[model samples]
Target: MEGPPVKIVALAIQGFVGQVLLDAGGNAKVNKQQFLHQVCKRIHSIGKNLFFEFKEKSFKLHFLMYGSYRVNEEKSR
Candidate 1:
């Protein structure tokens, strides 16, 4: 059986806000959760889906999906 080959695709799209942050600084003081929160806030303000996942080293956030946006701030029961 042939297994799935590893692949990585980077999109070079325009209009990415806070692109400079990808280089360095401003986020060192904040924790992972804090950074995620801030990003989520910004995405919500712009009405977009805040897709995120955390790995061993960093948190990955994607805000490309704009149509089916939803912000869940309600406390879980």
Candidate 2:
């Protein structure tokens, strides 16, 4: 149980295409809340941490600055 047990934090630049079309100015950036909601919902399908344990364990994830991802896992009690 002391293995690395690696967890991947992947970041997908949502709307990278749309961003190109929208004249920067200030509206090219993605919507943080919207993107977070989308990522959360998608992850929920597989359950947070991709564990899919809806009733047993509560899985949660967060998005970092500038469209970055941060995945963290700890020993489950």
Instruction: Give the C-alpha miss distance for residue 23 in model 1, angstroms.
Output: 27
The per-model lDDT (C-alpha) reads: 0.26, 0.26
User: Total clashes, candidate 1?
Assistant: 0
TM-score of candidate 2 to 2 decimals: 0.19
How many angstroms is residue 38 displaced in model 1 relative to the true structure, after the best TM-score fit?
A: 16
> Local error of candidate 2 at 51, Å?
9.7
What tens-digit string does per-residue lDDT give for candidate 1 at 1-77? 01111011111112333332222222235454433422211111212223222222334333343221112233346
Per-model TM-score on C-alpha atoms: 0.17, 0.19
lDDT value for model 1 = 0.26
